[model samples]
Target: MERLNAFDIRELERLCPGGVKENVSLAAISRWQIGGTADVIVEPSSVAELCSLRAFIAQEGLPSVVIGDTSNLLFSDEGLRAVCIRLGSRMSSVHIENDIVHAQAGVWVPFLARKIMSAGLTGAEHTCGIPGTLGGLICMNGGSQRKGVGSSVVTVESVDTAGNICHRSVEQCEFSYRSSVYQNNSEVIASAKLSFLSGDKLKIRQEMLSILAERNRKFPRKLPNCGSVFKSNPAMYEKAGPPGAIIESLGFKGACCGGAQVSPHHANFIVNTGVARARDVLTLVSKISRCVLESVGHHIEPEFKFVSVHGEIMPVDEMLKGFFYE
Candidate 1:
């Protein structure tokens, strides 16, 4: 708290007004309902305000993070000491021009899917069941194997740390398997232009409904959880089917650590059974990775991220040994 005052967080409030918040609980923002309080949270209601806030953070050399729907993220028990920027409803909008659908960063992927369905767009049906923001979906290349969200992207609009806006073509988006240029974490995704094919409205709606049903069957929705615990690499799947197959083969489905439990419905999902802490999930992930590696000679990488004890956002594989609490 003292550190916040020293950094003059009030100055940010002066700039953003009704947008800057202090001592925010991360649990409230994330899907898993985990983590402690953040030092500051900024919700930029518009793109201009978002750019201003990003500029401020950059000029101050302050630690900061941006959040979307937070379906794929987990925060540490220590919480975030950095300023966290969030895109609110005001920033979310979906517009269709012919066969192109334009959406802001804050638009939910599922919502976008529905909007596309209404517009008779076919390319984004696979995104209907993926829980994330348009920004996060593009950043993580999030979507199903049959049709990832990356393919629909035609152009990307972004704000850099210097507060300069830039646009990138689909080729420059550098989309690959579960990865994209946005992974650099150096830009704030503002909006994206998605090109799609025309389809029968009824067909698009039916496909979206089918995908949602399949997702509901696979995901443990009753429990609090990040979508998938580990990224299912091609080689891993080639040798062991889906990531869930590997976990099931290793006899780890339904495994529990403290209040965190691996979903019996999906081995790739780790859910909070109640009273689960960041440490519990971290420990479980480490143990599972080690077990999978030893048993199959293949390293399983975590898909979800955790706020490290160092107060940095990091994947499970990158954390320093002994840096996490047992």
Candidate 2:
């Protein structure tokens, strides 16, 4: 609370009105259900309010972090000492005009996929079961079946650190396997304009159902966990197969550290057995990385982002560079 003075909270309340909250539980917001409290949480109802809040934070030099659905984030056990700006239900809006779709950052991926499918759009069939928001999905260029959302991205709108809205074409996004320019920048995504091919609704629905069925058969849905713990490297896949298969070959399935366990169903997922801590998850990540490196001469990157107490977000593997040697 030392970082956020009473005056700051009052000002934030005035800016965002009913969207501001104090001492909110991060565990309740995170997919892993494993974080401590945050001093302040703000959900801007409109792009205008978000711009104002961003400007104020920049002007006052306040520590702040923006999150979408929190589906791929692992927050610290120690409470965050910054303002948490969550783009969620308030900002989740979708509009479609012919084959073009405009969606806000907070629209859930699954819901967005259904909307697109209903509109008879073809490109979003792969995102039908992703448990995240459009902001995070585009930030990570995420999709299943080796297809990325970047394929349909026509333009992206984001708010810079200075609160200026910026628009960029798909090329400027620098989309790659499980990454985008947003991952390395300070800008927060506001919305996106995407183009899709016209398709038969029945065919699209069948494709989405197939993908969902395969996911359900392979993934652990009964437990609380981030979707994937390791990024799938194309080169590594050719050399050693996918991360899940490799981790399973190394006997890591059902492995446990504190209350965190390597999912018995999917080797790439680390699940919370009711009570888990950030340290436990990181320990498992470090152990998995060490094993992978020792066995395959490949350093697998993590797909999940870890948010520290200071609001700094980094990949678990990057944070554990020294852990490899120790």
Candidate 3:
């Protein structure tokens, strides 16, 4: 690990009163339960702390990345040199104001959905079963049943790369199927406002339960995994059916590589059965992608982001190395 300069250490201390944890295990934080360690992992207690930390990193010329729950992320075993800025628990708050719900980025998605439903508000029911932070959902444009969170998003507040706060309306966000303006932009989402319709408590609860039950039935609760591996490409789905269906049809379900395997219930899900590595997950993903392309002529793109040991973004092919090795 590279040593932090005295100035950098002082800056980190000044910005995040609580000193950052060095060489924090990435496996412990990510859903995949795989990867090496982050050189520096800082949990900022408040928005101001986050802003200050960003400034410190910039001034120190250190690489940094902001992450939420690490649900849909794959990190290399070689570890990371970047300072990972995770929003502290203090940011996980959800508040209701009439028909709108304001949620901090660190708030869990399922919890946020429950809060909205408890307030007798509808439209968040589809998110009842998703696992991720509200900020991650917004960044990924997360959705189910053809309705995305962005559809209900009225406004978004984020911090740009320069630590400047920017507020944008739904119209300005440029939301697509499973992506938003935030996907490529180096902005960090702080909070969002979602609009909902008034509904009966019983009706909303029932809807939430139905979605939850469906997800539970399809995804195994015991295994650790990112919810879905590939984005649903409607065009590809129309031409060759869904990615899951194609992979399952090719007899890839229950396929195992190291500790990672494609779920028997849902081929789209690659599970970590106790001790899987990031390499194992990427290998499984590559095999599935190859099989899907050969069988259905569709190249399924992965939904997760791959971070390398050096804090550099990993290429899809490099991340999938050793996937075909027996």
Candidate 4:
């Protein structure tokens, strides 16, 4: 990784033209509201601008990270060393052509789902109330009620690690559970085309509203949380039921580590009660994982990516090491 200086902003301005914000608080952008600062936060207005920005970062040897909506992510309290790129609001348009819906990566999943429903399209109603952008949804293969977004995806257009634009169809995406091939590929999703069935607008709206109501009832709004913290492996829960049930049975509900607590409304969610640090959340998560493993002989994997410890962003490889090793 390389260090960035004031001079780099001049080059970034030339590449993006819209300018970038320096030393912006990551907490403002993240759902948890607990991250430190991002050295530079660039909101590129167009695909060309994004490409130019990537090229400039590579040429200048500046460390960079691209994030969308920041729903399933945890940033360090120490802060991030890399330049963070966020797609501009101008890139969030959703277009409907016949039965195909084309959505920009920056468009929120709920927004897109509403657009689809208003257009009398089905299949997307299940995504109602899901936080994050369309790109993050597809990248994470986000699902609800046993159905995932990948099932409706037809194609995706993204910028590869080398700054080359590429198109991948659903066949090439390799989506499973809460992950996709793009998870480790360093590719940034720009847009996606989804195929949906033509349906009654009134019925679609009703169904979507019902789903949202159910989600609100189950996950409530009393505390700040990133939905489910761990992925449920069926094999791990054969004797203990689902991960949530296992956690609930272990007397972990309302379990607190510092300011982080297991949400009483839902056992799977670890909420930031108030003034919670990244380490506090991690400590609680570790305690839950250990308790589950010790009591049920099963290790539950985390769904969200942990970006840092105290104030430092852990390397991606190092962050993933424990899951595979122990």
Residue-pair clashes per prediction, in order, are 0, 0, 1, 2
Model 2 over residues 1-326: C-alpha lDDT tens digits? 26688899999999998999999898887889999999999999888888999999999988889888888999999979988989888899999999999999999999999999999889899999999989999998999888999999999999988889999999999999888999989888999999999999999999999999999999999989999899988889999999999999999999999999999999999999988999899999999988999999898999999898988888777777665322
Write out the backbone clash pairs for model 2: none
What TM-score does candidate 4 get on C-alpha atoms? Answer: 0.93
lDDT (tens digit, per residue) of candidate 3 on 95-202 = 899999988888989888899998999999999888888988998899898889999999999887677788999988899887898877778788899999999989
Task: Choose the strongest candidate by TM-score.
Answer: 2
Off by over 4 Å in 1: 309-311, 323-326
Error of 1 at 128 (Å): 0.7
Cα lDDT tens digits, model 1, 1-326, are: 13467446777877677888777777777788889888887777777887888888788777777777878788888888777877656678888999998899998888888888898878888888887889888888888845568888899998888778989999998998778887775788999999999999998888888888888877889989998888877787888777788888889899898989889888989999888888888888888888888888788888876664334666667863565545
Query: All models: lDDT?
Result: 0.81, 0.91, 0.82, 0.80
10 residues in a row with least lDDT, candidate 3: 310-319
Off by over 4 Å in 2: 323-326
Total backbone collisions, model 4: 2
Residue 272, model 3: Cα distance from true site in angstroms = 1.2
User: If scored against the real structure, what TM-score would every candidate get?
Assistant: 0.94, 0.97, 0.93, 0.93
Model 2, global lDDT: 0.91
Q: Report RMSD (Å) for each prediction in the order shown.
A: 1.9, 1.4, 2.1, 2.9
TM-score of 1: 0.94
